[model samples]
Each structure stands twice: as C-alpha cells, then as structure tokens.
Target: MRVLHIITGLKAGGAEQQLRQLLRHLPPEAECDVVTLTSPGLVADGLRADGVRVRHLGMSGNRDLRALPRLVRLIRAGGYDLVHTHLYRACLYGRIAARLAGVRAVVASEHSLNDAEMEGRRRTAGVRALYLLGERLGRVTVAVSPTVAEDLRAWGVPRSRIRVIPVGFDPALFRFDEVRRKTARNFYGLPEDAYVVGGVGRLIPGKRFEVLVRTLPHLPAGARLLLAGDGPEKEALWRTARELGVADRVVMTGERPYVPDPGDDAPGMPDLMSAMDVLAAPSAMETYGMAVVEALAAGLPVLYTAAPAVSDLPADAVPTAWHVPCSAEQYGRELLRLYAAHPGERTVPDVVQRNSIQNIARQTMDLYAAVLSDAPLEVRPR
Candidate 1:
C-alpha cells in the first residue's frame, strides 16, 4: 500500500521521533513518503537515510495559503492509498488537501491536548469549531492516550472516530547498558559518584522544569540534575536555576541531535537514560510519556506526574514507574527514598512488548485497512 504522511515539521520532538520510528518498522509491502509543512529539521536526514522520501513544502509561516494547493497537487499526483497526518496544523491542512485530491482514506493523530490550553485560552467555541471541522474531514482521529481521546470527545470529536494507540519505542535500542552508562557520564563530565536526576523534553512552562530545578537544593550534595531538550523557555529555566542557587548542579544539553546509528557509539536517548540514577517527569500534562517509557525500558526508576500512558497500563507493565505529586518537595522526598534503596533491574517486558515500533506499525496498518474497507464517514463504537 502507498501512504503519505503529513506533519507540521520534522523536528526532534516526541511526535516527530515517533513518526520516524514507526516508518522504520513499517511492513515491507508499505511504501511511505513524508511531507513536512515547514522545513525538515533533524529528523529529515534520518528518514531519508532509512529510504523514506521526505519533501519540504517551504511554507513561510502559518498564513501560507500556497501550501494548500501545492499539497493537494502532490497528493493527487502521488496516488497515495492513504493520507496520515500528525500535529495540529498538519491535521487541519492535510485533511482538507487529501479531500480535495479525492483521497478516500485520511487519518490524523492527536499527540497532545495540553492541560493548560484545554483549561486556558483555548477553551473557546472557535477552537472547538476548528477542531471539529478538521476532524470531520478525516476518516479517523487517533489519540495517543485515552486521556487525549477523552479530551477529543469533549471537544466534539465522536468517540467512535477516536482510536487509542500509544506511541511506540524500540526496547532493544533503549535497553540498559553498563558500558554506555559509564561512557555517557564520562562524556558529560559527571562525577562518578554523583546521583543524577534526569528529565527529557522541551524546556517549556508546561513541562515544569522549574520544579525540577527547585528540587535540586533539597537533594543531597552530590545529586545533579540533567535536562535534555531545548525550547524557548530555556533562558527562563537557566534564570530559575540561578535564582534557586543550583545553577552549578543543573546541566542543560540543548536539543540533542537525532542520530539513529546503531553502532556509532555516540550518546543517544538510551545512553542518556543509562547515565541517570532516576528519571523525573514533572510535566503538568502529557498525552503519552515517551521519555517515561524509554527510561523504564533503560531500567531506570521514574518519578512522574500524571503520565496517563504509563498509569493506564496494568500495574505490572511499568513496575518501576511511580506516580508522584507535581511538587519539588514530593519529588525530593522520592529521590531521597530512591537514593537510599536503589531500584534494581526492573525490565517491563509487557510494556516493551506492547509498545514496540513493529507492533504499533502493524496495528496502524490494520487501522488503514479497516478504514479503507469500511469507507464510513462516521463510525460507531465497536
């Protein structure tokens, strides 16, 4: 089957990384191509290296109407069997373009319905109307977590049209390695005996990285904090670290490049997780906690705040993940306990099996087949 994926951009974000991983595990019979509304960033090269054709629309900004017609033309010319869209802007434009191109099958995935937006400025009729319009254009809307699906339903997307498909990761790649852990720590110049607490994601307000920084002062003397990822809030986070008097203990590795080279011996997400003593996810909201899952896969105990993706699982699936309050004090207390009683190897076989990229790709392919065969504009819950 021929499929085309449309995304806002090919940056090194969770959704972008998930897309790349999914494509890598797609069945051999599936021919996939990607089109980014904006310029392709780090993920483009890796996708191309994996033999996936990626195109940039060269959109100047959000107001670029020319991209619509160009996208429609491309879809029509490619004769793709399905159009899969990711992110907000991509969903809005890709669905419309696919319909204009006479494509019968179109699907979109909702990676986040951030709590701040849902309860803040975005809780208005206009946003809901636009979302409903875009959802109506697609055959189905995939929710990365059940929590996101509930939010979509609240925003007027019919429950029947929503499918809960958690994002996947490769366990083999993220699994723990003692050698890589030592090497990553050495490369980062972390002291051998330092107790590292790590967080990974965009340095945004919603992530509440400030809370993690504040927790540093409460931690033991050798406890260090590492935040891997970058965003507009980086400067603010640095300022917070300075004000909290833990600037020296905080390490901000600005957006790590996405290099999927297996044998390259370079530090990646796996190595970074291995270097940490425990992973802390203090985000106010998350549709699916990709980093939490990855940390668990790498054999690190996790202290997270409301990770539906992890919490929704059967308790046995993520035994090492502890749901804690989104407070620096609570997190500090947990860290002390974890430091005292080191969390041993707790590999979640169930989580690894359920969230494998190959499994997710096959499930997604099944959804495509079902959508094509049924050809229902509106579906009823199964």
Candidate 2:
C-alpha cells in the first residue's frame, strides 16, 4: 500500500507528533510519504533525515489558490493508493486533490476541534458542505477521541464515515526517573527545596500562561513557575511576571534548539516534569490536552482550565488533575490549594496508560487495514 500523509505544516504540535507516530508505525509493506502545504519545519526536517520522502507545496496562509494544481500534480505523480490527511487545511486540500487525481482512496484524521468553524451559520454552512464532499471523496475519517467523533457528527459529517482512534505515546520514554529529574532541575538552577509548577505550549495567548503566573503569588514563597516555549506573547508574559513581583521565580527557557523526534514519546528536555511537583495547563482552549497526558505520563498531576475542549479526558483521569474555573483569581486559589497538598496521591500511571502512544498506533494501523479493505481497487493513472 502506498500512502501519502498531508499536513498544513511540520510545526511541533500534537497533530504533527501524531503524524510522526503514524509514519513510524505503518506496516513495512505500506509505503509512506509526507506532503506539507507550507514550508516544513523541525519535524519535517527530521522525517526527511529518517528517509521519508518529504514534499513541500510552498503555499502561504489559508487562501493559497495556487496550491490546488500543485497538490493535484503531486498526488498524481506519486500514484498513491491512499491519501491520509491531518488537520483542516490538509483535509480540505488532500481530499479534493486525491479525488481530482483519481487516487483509489482518501482518508482524514481529525486531531482536535476547531471552534471558530462552528461559531456561526456562515462558517458552519461552508464546513458542512465541504465535509459532505469529503465524505464522498474520502472513504473514511478518524477522530482522535470519542468526544471528537461525537463532535464531527454534530457538525453534519456522516456518522457512518467516522471512527474513534485514541491518541498514543510510548510508555518507555515516559517512565518515572528521579535521577534525570534532579539533573534537569539542577541544570536549570531550579530550587531543589521549592515546588516547581510548569507548563509547555506554543506560548500563545490562548494558553493562559498569565493565569498560571497569577497563581504564583497565592502559593508558598518556595513555589516557582517555569514556562517552556516561545511565541509573540513571550515578552508580554515576561512583563506580567515582573509586574506580579514573581519575576525572580519565573524562568522562561525559551524554545529549545532541538525538540524530541516525532518517534520519541518523551520530550527532549531533561524530564523536568518528573522534578515538578505539579503541572499546570490553564489553557482557555485546548482540544485534546496532549501536554496534560504527557505530564501525567511523567507521574506529575495536571491542572487544566475547565473548558469543553478539555472535556475529552476520562472521568477516572480527573482525580489526578484539577480543573479550575477560567477566572485568574479562582484559578490561582485552586493552584495554591493543590500546592499546599504537596505530592498528593493520584492515579498518574493509569491516566498515562489510557493515552499511551503504542495503543494509539496499534488502533491506527488497524484502521488503515480496515479502510484499505473497503477501498475500491486502484486504477492505473491516466
């Protein structure tokens, strides 16, 4: 089986990481290549180094009219038996291009929810029509979680065409390790006696790092905040921390020069999570909470903001986490309360197992086989 995986970009994000998992776990009999609608980044560069055929379409932004012909040409030239797309841009273009190129089958994997598309009749109407076209052209669609599957149904995607495939991470990379924790903390000059609360993300405004910073004052003086990321909002976040009078306790590591390979389950950074007393993910919006799961895998409890997008985590997993109200003051109080409980017993392992990558990959490969079995036989390219 020849499969082409299409994505908007190769940025280091949950969807990109999942795509890496897909490429690594695909059966050897299946030939896999990746196509990016924009310039590939660190993740794409890594994939190519590992011998995956990586193609860039050089499209800019959402309104790239020129991408269609280029996309069609690539799909036709590759003679792919299947085209699998990740995220919206890829899904929109890949399905259309696959059908235009007369590929045997087209499939899309929905990694997270996009609320902006569902906010109104205009976007909703356009999306519904697109999905209808996609449902006919793309033989199957995969939702990363049950909640995501239900969401697609509500948005008018045919229920018959959608299936739930849980996201996964390798357990080996996430095993608890104390020595590594100590090393990471010491290397970064984090106070050993202090309770460390940290978060990881693109440093975007929606992530609510300010909320976490606001929570710092409510906690004990020994508590400190560490943010691992970089974005347009970094300078402003730094300013906020300084204004809060906790600048001394704030450490922004900026973006690491190199992140973990997509195949790696654990982040490349010193397992700082293991050293952390707690992980705070107060994002006002997050679809799947991949970072929350990663922290749980590292045996650190998580605190996420109460949002519908974060509702996918199972109830059992809630015990290991704290969901705070969206308000910064209330969030701060809740975070401090948890910190006071210090090393509270929680089912960190179970939550991690539920989101492990190996199980996710196994289910994905099964979906591939199922989709292929039902797919029409491929015709020779004209």
Candidate 3:
C-alpha cells in the first residue's frame, strides 16, 4: 500500500507532529512519503531522519495558482495508491490535485477545526465554502475528536464521510519516573519543591496562554508557569508576565530543537511534562486536547478549559483532570486549591488506552483497505 501525505507545512504544530507520529506507527507493508506545500522546518527534518522521502512545493501562499498543477504532476508521477491530506491548506490543494492526477481514493484529516475558529483563525463563510468544496473531493474526512466531527456535520458534511480518530501518544515515552523528573526539573532550572504549572503546544493567542500568565501573580510565590512550544505570541506573553511583576516566576522555553525521537539527547515534550507539577490548558476551544492526554499519560494532574478527547468518557475515567474556567482568577484559585491538596502523579487514564497509536494505526489501515475496495466508509466510535 503506497501512500502520499500532503500537508501545509512541516512546522512543529499539532497537525505536523501528528502526521510524523502516524507515519511512524503505520504498518511496514504500507510505504509512505510526505509533501509539504511550504516552510518545511523541524518536523520536515525529523521525517527525513526517519528515512521518509519529503518534497517541498515552494508555491508561496493560499493564492499560489502555480501549486495546483505542481502538486498534480507530483501525484501523477508518484502513482500512490492513496493520498491523505492534513491541515486546511493541504486539504484544499491536495484533494484537487489527487483528483486531477486520476487518484480517486483520497482522504483528509481536519486537525484544528472548532465551531468559531480553525487553527486560530476565525471561521468565515468563505473559508467554510472552500473547505466543503475541497472536502467533497475526498472519500473520507478524519476528525481528531468527536467535537470536530460534530462541527463538520453541522457544516453540512454527510455523517457517512466523517471519521473520528483521536490522536495517540506512546505510553512508554510519557510514563513518570522520579529520577527523570528530578533531572528534567534541574535541566530547566526549576526548584525541587516549586509548584510548576505547565502549558504545552504552539504558543498562539488562541491558546489563551496569557490567562495562565495573568494567573501567576495570584498564586503563591513558589508557583511557576512554564510554557513550552514557540510561536509569534512568545514575546507578547513575556511582556504580559513582566507587566504583572511576575517575570521571574514565568519561564518561556522556546521551541524544543528536536522531536520525540527515541534516544535523542535533547529534552522533548515528555521531559518538559516530567518537569511540571500540573498541566494547564487555557484554550476554551480545542479539536482534541493532546497536551492534556500526554500529561495524563505522564501521570500529572491536568486543569483544562476544554478537552474533547476526554469529553465522551465519564468523569471517573479521568479523575485527575478537572475542568476550570479560562480565567486568571479561576485558574489561580484552582491551582491554589489543588496545591493545598498535595497531588502527585496519578495512573494513566483510560482515555489514553482507547486512543493508543497501535489501535489507531490498525483502524486507519482498515479505512485504507475499505476505501481502496469501494466499501462503505464506516464511522467507528472511540
């Protein structure tokens, strides 16, 4: 089974990282390659190191009329059995290109779609029209969470065409270790007893990380807010911390240089998770709460505004995770309350088990087989 994955870029964002991880877990019998429309960066390097062929199409931006034909030619030349598109830009262009290249079995994954916005941009009418148009060109559309699947259905997508496949994490990489925790804390210059509140994922305005920064001054002096990931909002977050007179209490670690490649010396997301006492996701909107899931796998307590990844399950399913409003005062109060309770690493939740990469890869392979043989696309539940 030869497949080609096309994405907007190879930057270290949710969709890009998920694509890399998915490729890693795919069956060896299924060969895969990647195509990035533009700005291939850290994830691109990681994919190449994994021995996957990656091609970059320098077609500029959304209005790049030249990219369509270029992508079409590449699809025709590769003669892939199926083409899977990730992210918004690649979905639109890739679906059209695959059709033009005579490839009928195409699939697209909607990684960052929420009700009001997508990938931090507000969902406009024009965007919806274009998305639907592109969506029709593909045989199936994968939604990372049930919430996103509902969003797609509300937008007029047929229920038969949408698939809910939550993203997965390797439990081995995230299991808690006292020695690793101490080492990671020392690596980040965190004190042995400090109450660390971590915010992971791309530093974007839509993430409401500023809410965490604002909550810092309300917490005890020993409390620290460590934000991982990098983006245009980094400088602004620092300014907010400084303005609140808690600059010393806030640590902004820019983009980690490497991904979660086994045996890599550089500290990855799991190390950052280990260095934290609590994981806080301030975003009110989320397609799937990957950070929350990863923190749970690492056995850290999570305070999140929205995590559709765990929404379908019972509260007992994720006892360590609590829903908190996306406000500085609420977050501050919750953190202080939880701190007084003296929480530690909890067992990995059932949600992680349900979304394991092994199971997801098997389901995906089933989808590919069905699509190839003209079978009805079944919408499997989590």
| Top-scoring candidate (TM-score) | 3
What's the CA error at residue 19 for candidate 3, in Å? 1.0
> In model 1, how large is the Cα lDDT of residue 203?
81
Clashes of 3: 0
Give one digit per residue, the lDDT tens place, for model 3 in 1-382: 8999999998777778778878889999889999999989889989998999999999697899899999999999998999999989899999999999999999899988887886556799999899999999999999888888888999888898999887865767788877877887887788989999999978887889999999888888999989988898999999998899998988877665335556656577778888889999989888888888888888888999988987767778998889999999998888989899886546787667877777888878988998999898777433
When superposed on Cα atoms, how far off is each prediction in RMSD? Answer: 2.5, 5.0, 1.7
Per-residue alpha-carbon lDDT of model 2 for 1-382, expressed as tens digits? 8889999888666677667766766668779999999858767877876689998899987788789999999989998888999877788888889989988577788775655442111346666787667667787778766666777777777677787766666655655677867776786788788788888877887778888888777878988888877677898888898898998998776543123555654335337666677778877655577777777777777788733323665576456776877767876777777767777543455556766666766766666776778853232111
In model 1, which regions exceed 4 Å deviation?
118-121, 257-266, 315-317, 375-382
Better of 2 and 3 by lDDT: 3
RMSD of 2: 5.0
Q: What ranking emerges by TM-score with the best candidate at the front?
A: 3, 1, 2
List candidate 2 segments past 4 Å from native. Answer: 114-124, 255-270, 306-314, 344-347, 375-382
TM-score (all chains, Cα) for each model: 0.93, 0.87, 0.96
The per-residue C-alpha lDDT of model 1 at residue 112 equals 62
The total number of steric clashes, by the backbone 3 Å criterion, in model 2 comes to 4
| Local accuracy of candidate 1 as per-residue lDDT tens digits, 1-382 | 8899999988778899999999988888879999999958768877988889999999888779999999999999999999999988788889999999999699898886766564223556776777789889988998888778888887788888988787987888877788888998888888888999999998878889888898898888899998989888999988988998988988887665445454545577778888898999998778788888888788788999968778877887777889999998999899999989965665655666678887899889888888878754343322
Best by lDDT: 3
